[model samples]
Target: MHRRTFLQSAAAVSGLLPLAARPSFAGLYQAAAVATGDLDAVRGDGRPVTLPASAIKDLAASLRGPVLLASSPGYETARRVLNPSIDRRPALIVQPTGTADVRRAVSFASAHGLLLAVKCGGHSFSGMSTCDKGMQIDLSNMRGVRVDPKARRAYVEGGTLLGLVDHEAAAHGMVTPLGTVSHTGVGGLTTGGGFGRLARKFGLAVDNVVGVDVVTADGSVRRGDPTENPDLYWGVRGGGGNFGIVTNFEFQLHPFSGTVTGGEVVFPIDRARDLLRVYAEWSQKAPDEVYVDFVMSQPPGGKGGIALLHVCYCGDNADRDLAVLRTLGTPMANTIKVQRYVDFQKSGDYTDARTMGEYMKSGFTTGISEKLISGIIDGFEPHPARSTGVFTQHSGGAIGRPPVGTCAFPHRHAQHALMAAVSWKVGDDGAPHMAWAKKYWATIEPLTSGFYINEVNDESRAVLNANYRENFPRMVAVKKQYDPTNLFRLNANVQPA
Candidate 1:
């Protein structure tokens, strides 16, 4: 997965290699030899706490998985997250192997009043999955996915990557709408309103979720579905990780042909404005099977900014729709072709990996207006050492079919999700890049209605409440009922009432 391969494959496709293709974590959990000592930790409110060496040893011995301290063999790697910009060391890291391990870890954290963070794929942009001098429940060792062809369903472990689900379901000629990136943790993505190539057709990942096995703040493993704990189920769909730690998810899968016509149509930056105007109108009428993204990026070391229309068409009328897109403007490069859906899902893996230091600001838009197009073009300033861009993921269709209050995700009427993003080298000074992104967002933010919770970064509680709208109170009630103490307050937090 080289940079050239990514560009040729359309780097905007959700990025992730299959689980088998990822690096092995075999020796990362050899915790038996690590000596236990008194641990200094922090409570959720930044208060200090300590666990006696005897208690640490007993807790380690209780779990079937490994308990990693700072001195452990793989502690360094275990603490690292996808965003290199976020560097925090937890007092102890618990690598859970199953639901039992998760329950024990949560119970221990609760008993000790230790600030707890949960890490799946470690792709949280805000670094909510990791914390300093706290306890981190790392799910890296729990990647397991099972697909039932007869039932057209996927049972994904809480720590499973989206790529694993894609691989397993594709084998059964089925698909579930997960996030855009294949390596994203299913737990964080689905709980935050998952969106991907097939989202328009099949709905979000949360929408497909039929049931969940979760460990709440009380360390109780509870099952939630329409019939069992329906309120909890509703809260989990779009309420984020505020309610509980989802140990397992049962998702309804849809039949999908293994192959689809998809790829990128790249145009010079000059044609961006006109093309966006055309896309604003054309995308509204596009069928459910047509999923597209408008991406603008100035690749590091590239000549200038370029606009790309990333297309994934599963319908029979791709030829007609694509022809219309090809005529939008003279594209500098057109890589559109028939490709396996699984392969397309992996196309952006290299790009995602390359952009280790990432900053993003995103919001849901009702439609692409002339003002937004102008704001995006005007604010986009290319940096020679960074990859900077503005992009839009097509929404609507199945996403809006469900009523606003059907689940916790309230932004059902948005037609597209717009984001301004910039990425630099891991250790480089990101201040300039972040400043640019914020300035760029300042112009477009006013045009947005609400935001997709997954991309939330540094937004205030007032903004969160406004975005959640009428559902905020209900989410607060669920949070109070499950996490009254706000144990899981790291995410797009819903403070308990």
Candidate 2:
């Protein structure tokens, strides 16, 4: 049977269907939970079975953390993840206080044929971390990060978020290649070869990944890194979560913890044409210590604005980084100042926790021509009267090239990772933003190197092929070794070997 069809049937039979069918599964799961004397089964809506005292004792002995059944008060809180879009009511949400808890949860889920979801920062835009009516291995409480000042490496738990990583590393005057959004999860991002402001100078988030200890699908613990389990190590570097549940990551750190000079500069809508043109030109030859990014959004009036850019320099001279920006040209607003790296990351902070009915697209650019520029501009003009602006970033530095087949992230030599985001507030103007961006992208067809894997869209099937490119086959091989059944199948997926 097709995997999805089999999965759906299994879920229905196991009494773990989506919320729409949650009622039906609740009974079957409850019975299993009772019979096994373990928290193995759960209804789609998360109701637990009434177990006898003997069963409770057995379940408690097997758990590393509190084994929360659906009726428990903590069940509601334990069941939640970061993204609002994920409304999954798992049969059980196991907040594993430690590694043992995680293992037990994994074991139970596997034995019972339950769907599983792994959540760290809960910021996944694609909702891959949510299991509608199965098991959840939530690593929220496993927060721990220890940095080695001498070795310049950090031991970070799977639950750590980018913002926390930045804050802790800054305390030691050190840093690592992370993600653009501070709220992004370290585990998912690292596994997928994440990029950040430091990418041009250092590399991708996964490039700094020295080692990882994961709990595989079958409940076996394995260490993944270059020296041991080399294939699995490379697979996780950018392979997404096809292997297993990662518990910790050891990363290489650099002297970027202290304050540096950086911030955003907003340009008038009228200057977007010229500004983007200049940005495209300057980025090609920009230095290692400097990074440039652009954000174009639909603002009030008929005009869309440009976030001129943000630059971060790890050098001792803040003036040199400032000069890089000045050398580019004068800006309407340069918030660039002597500030910590964390401060720079927060400059573009969007406080609205509210996820919107948005149509956001992400992709990489090896080259952007005048024709492409016009198309992007045309897409922005009539978006949500006040929606996200364009975001442009430099690429291709130390992080750009690894063995091409080393990981799933393929755009090794690509130049820029740009995003075309069109979102709106409730009852706000949103149609124009979606229409404009989609049409503009259509106009720029054939210019983009396949869509970057992270920016997957229904029409962007070709993009995934490009993102993995030469490494696609290797990824399949590694995937098969760890997850032959593709239990963790989701995201811009690579079929298991």
Best by lDDT: 1
Deviation of model 2 at 450, angstroms: 3.2
For model 2, how does the per-residue alpha-carbon lDDT over 359-431 read when each residue is reduced to its tens digit? Answer: 5566678867787788777655543243445666678767666767656667787788766655444365556
TM-score of each: 0.93, 0.82
Prediction 1 TM-score vs. true: 0.93
Clashing pairs in 2: 15-25, 42-91, 173-257, 174-257, 295-390, 296-389, 296-390, 297-389, 383-433, 451-463
Model 2: worst 10 consecutive residues (lDDT sum): 1-10
List RMSD in Å for every model shown.
Answer: 3.5, 9.0
Q: Please, what is the whole-model Cα lDDT of each candidate in the order they appear?
A: 0.83, 0.65
